[model samples]
Target: MFNVELTSERIARERLETRRKREAERQERIFKEKVRTIGVDVKALDMQVEEKKARKGAYVLLKADAEDRRYNFEACVHQNRQKKKSREMEKALVNYRHQHQMPSTRREFDLNDPDCYRKLDPGDAQMMLPGLAGEEQDSKSRLKRQKEQLREWLLCQQKELRQGKLRKKRVIKGMMAHSSMPWTWCLVCVPARTGESPPRACNRSFSSRSTRSRRRR
Candidate 1:
């Protein structure tokens, strides 16, 4: 029984020792620099980088495809607009030619007609007289208008001349009036004697004499 007990104890101690060794190994794996260093997982980071690069490449391709589609759409719209404009221009040209470019409306048709003189009525001969009577009437009217305009121009020139003469007369009259006015005299009294005061008066002749004397000096 003692040997059996000893064997059991030994077995339990061996299990405990094995468990302690495994715990120590686990701690070493968690705390050691080689196993738990201060750095990211290179494989995980590389995979993330590759994923980001793939996403960026896909975006670039999608953007380029969208731009190409947009350009093609705009080009197709522009082509359709141009085609419509060309069709409208062609239609307008065809309409214009049909309306105004008929052969009968052309001057050459009259010259080329074989019965050009035979188609004239009795009054048509007078109508084809090169409009000399109308030209004479227009000349008479033009001469009358020219005479009337010349009369009006002469009247206007005479009126302007009269106004200029009146303005000149007024200017000359103003100048003569200004020159004929009495001269202004400023009297500066001499310092009086201690007991005498002098009278102040308008002294035009005295001022004139003083002005002449200053001029002579």
Candidate 2:
């Protein structure tokens, strides 16, 4: 009876474990169907993940290519600099050799080379003018005539100024002589209480004196 009971218990436990595994599988299928009903495709998600991985791989290749190109460019620049330095050193050596007269035939400078100057105008580059002497004589005569005219003008201006001054001096002298006479305008505006006579008294006296002087003459 104990051995029979043990076999029965073992069989019941096996049955329960089998039911649990079946229920878990059933729940997983139901959840997958619900996700499909909502339009979530697992295949498309897998493709997107694959594309992202591909893009990451391409970016890494591109970065490597860029690094390689940069290193190549740096190498080329270094080579070019070495070539330039070598050329400069060669040029300096040649110049030093030329200055030391290592070569017997030295280059000579040519002054008469036609390439040194611009082309000359044929019409304007003719010989000296034949009438140069005659033109010089004419210019000299013209200058002398101009000098004479200028001198005459200055003389006329001086003579006019001298005559004007003489006329002004004579007028001033006449005015001074008339001022001592009592009948002048100098005494007319002055006060009568002064030593000088008034205008009316001096006029009558001068008129009478003029008649007397006229009779005596």
Whole-model Cα lDDT per candidate? 0.74, 0.70
Alpha-carbon lDDT of model 2: 0.70
On residues 12-100, what C-alpha lDDT tens digit does candidate 2 reach at each position?
99999999999988778778865334557789999999999999999999999999999999999999999999999999999998888
Residue pairs in steric clash, candidate 1? none
- In terms of TM-score, the best-performing candidate is 1
Report the lDDT tens digits of candidate 1 across residue range 193-212: 22333355655324445555
Highest lDDT: which candidate?
Answer: 1
Quote the RMSD, in angstroms, for model 1: 16.9
Going through the candidates in the order shown, the clash numbers are: 0, 0
Over 4 Å off in model 2, which ranges? 1-4, 31-49, 52-60, 63-67, 74-78, 97-217
Per-candidate TM-score against the hidden true structure? 0.34, 0.31
